[model samples]
Target: MPRTQAGDPLTERTIRVLDAVLDDFGGRRFAVRDWTGRRHDPPGPAEFELILTGPGSLRAMFFPLNDRTFGEAYVTRAIDVEGDLVAAMRVAYTIIETRVPAAVRARQLRLLLTLPRAGTGRPRELRARRGGRAHSVARDRRVNDFHYSRSNDFYRLWLDEWMAYTCGYFRTDADSLDAAQVQKFDLVCRKLRLREGDRLLDVGCGWGGLAIHAARHYGAVVHAVTNSTAQAELAAERVAAAGLAGRCRIELTDFRALDDTRRYDHVSSVGLVEHLGPAVWRTYLAKVWRLLEPGGTLLNHGMTGKAGEPVGSPFLDAYVFPDARLMTIGATVRAAEDAGFEILDVENLRRHYARTIRAWRERLDAAEAEAVALVGDRTVRVYRIYFAGLEHAYRRGRINLHQTLLQKSPAGRTDLPMSREDWYAPPQR
Candidate 1:
């Protein structure tokens, strides 16, 4: 950490640059606390404050002026956020994307040059570095293991009773996480119109939440696949305990490895496509198409992003789901159409997902002690920030959750009800 001398030009320049950027963001109601306990308050009511750990924190925060930098600053404890992390993140993002005059930019560059280029290193065991080509079957397996295999007990701290890791469909503000998750599973079942004795394929299934629900409630025989060892074991145990062992099979295998000869009445890929990589979108859809019986429906649920946006912050791509990429809904639909499937429906669950992440964030924050005990301090911190950032991303539309329905219409035949009322209506007694 460098010390700022009294009356130093860098000190004045840093203040000036901060003033300019804060004004550029319309003087957002956030404050900043320097290492010396000096306060830089905004003009109005404040929701959060950024506390710099040392003089080098400024360097770590704005040296490159990117999402990864801001995220790394917090993760490394170079800067700490007190109150409203999402609000602070919004301000940081606005400043990052805000344009300024050439003169102001020059001053910012000068101040950045005067500060130390590095911080006190990163958080312990924070970065996840994987070798081999991105999205390769072997690498994808390792990536899934890195994220999903970090102790099922840790996930139990935050996720719902079913441990449905993807977005949950919240019908209203009063929907509990557990109920919403069940609704999400049922929503998938209804969209596919899953029925008794129907063969279902749940690819990239996390803990087999959907499989168990589909079998127990809908009487669908499900073959769920996952690349995670812990998930497969736990999901199988849950399935057996529920007395659905004969109906639901949890297989620890990549979706690509499934033999095409074995087909299914419905293919539901929730939270799986993002990892298949954009280049393989065509082949990925084709694989699902081949595995589905004629007139069978496929429910593709996953995250999406607008074109030209980065897949995610560098911190996310490196540490979480390293093989994942978010393609826009349009591209996803086009790929499905190219794979010989008729587009049935595309519903954006972005708002519901925001609510879902908010619940997870609150639950995780409440169980921070248990999470830290189970997975260590660094893992807990990483995930806390991850959930917060994700919630902000979804709320602000930087990303979205799309549940798309497609069908292999044999000779232009269809099985879907005429309206969405059947999908959302209450169950019959």
Candidate 2:
């Protein structure tokens, strides 16, 4: 690394820390050490600069007290990555492992668990623009933009080749994301009791993963709805490619626009309720209630809260997912009942989510460079911290995930189905 021109203490310390971390990683990976200041065969500045300035480039952001603030700033986009995001992540991880002692790391972890967050305060500018109905024309567009508007290239880094943005179903320690996503898709299909010629509706479909799977594997006609325009277009293209365009349709709209005249035999939503906001959970369930045909089954796969209401993670609200809310199992069940759906089953896959998130974060760490090149440093940092924090939360049991099976009663009876023969994969254990 080059010497600080002004010999400032913070800059000097940062450079030293960066160098030490890079050196350690180089030792582990047996990769060449590329330092700008030290006498090493480092990557050329022009090459490094290109890694930063080109599309998908990521620049590293260094801070004086990473333990104190990096996590929150990343969530807020307060810290930016300029170029070569993957390299930046490798560097950051190395710095943490080498520059910070184990004792300090433990202390930081404890602090994170106990620290209170700032009040739920939206930016003044954002407050000025609060629109009616969280998912209204303006607010809906903003929510879509907050997530799907991100670069496909950026998503490609951590997500499976199919670009599944929902949770994965881990069957074994050896199952890769490619296999796990397939597993998850099959699981949902089985749980919903999909049958040939059955019509299915996917609410909050992300890139139409579940819809495409059902139509292709189960021979079901599918209609999918999403709030993101990017997802709708991509899903349409995928459906057409699979020659399921006739069988599956992707709609770029909200659930409120659904025509009540139409009903599906099967319904599934994955990881979508988080964006529904706390105030609308009941209303959203009512929409689901009205969308399902009599005797139809609805599968809601979402992350749940261990406790009702907020824990005040301002960073998550401001940077990661704006206006997102999590509901406890008790509240979610009541909401379903209020919508007049009988809750036939509730399965908590909390541990699976912990493993799933770990897998995702690891994959993101591995593909950091490609991600940064696509989105830039700030976004890369945002994802890294977000993934890490989420992993911690899940492992600590502060959050939960569930796959609830709800049914719209035909004769107001819950004992219609006796055979669960096809409702699950063979015991993997």
CA lDDT of every candidate: 0.82, 0.66
Model 2 misplacement above 4 A: 1-133, 308-312, 414-416, 419-421, 426-429
lDDT of 1 by residue, 1-429 (tens): 122234445444555556655665565466767777766666666688878777677778876877677777877788889898888777777767667788876676675777765556766375666799877788878888888888999999899998999889878788899989999999999999988999999988889899999998999999999999889999999999998989999999987799989989998989888877677778778888888889888999999997766666776876666767789999999888888999989999999899998899899989989988998876786787778788888988989899999999977788577888889975653
Who wins the TM-score comparison? 1
Worst 10 residues of 1 by lDDT: 1-10
lDDT for model 2: 0.66
Lowest summed lDDT across 10 adjacent residues in model 2 is found at 50-59
Residue-by-residue lDDT tens digits, candidate 2, 1-429: 432344435333433443344444452221222222222224334112211111111112222334224444333443334333344434444444355567755554443333223232222332113356765657866766767777766776778877878778887889998888878888898888788999999988888888998998888999999988888888899999989988999999888889988988988889887777565777778877787777888899988887733443445666667677787877888888878888888988888877877777788878878887887655676677666666666766767888998899866766446766766655342
TM-score of each: 0.93, 0.71
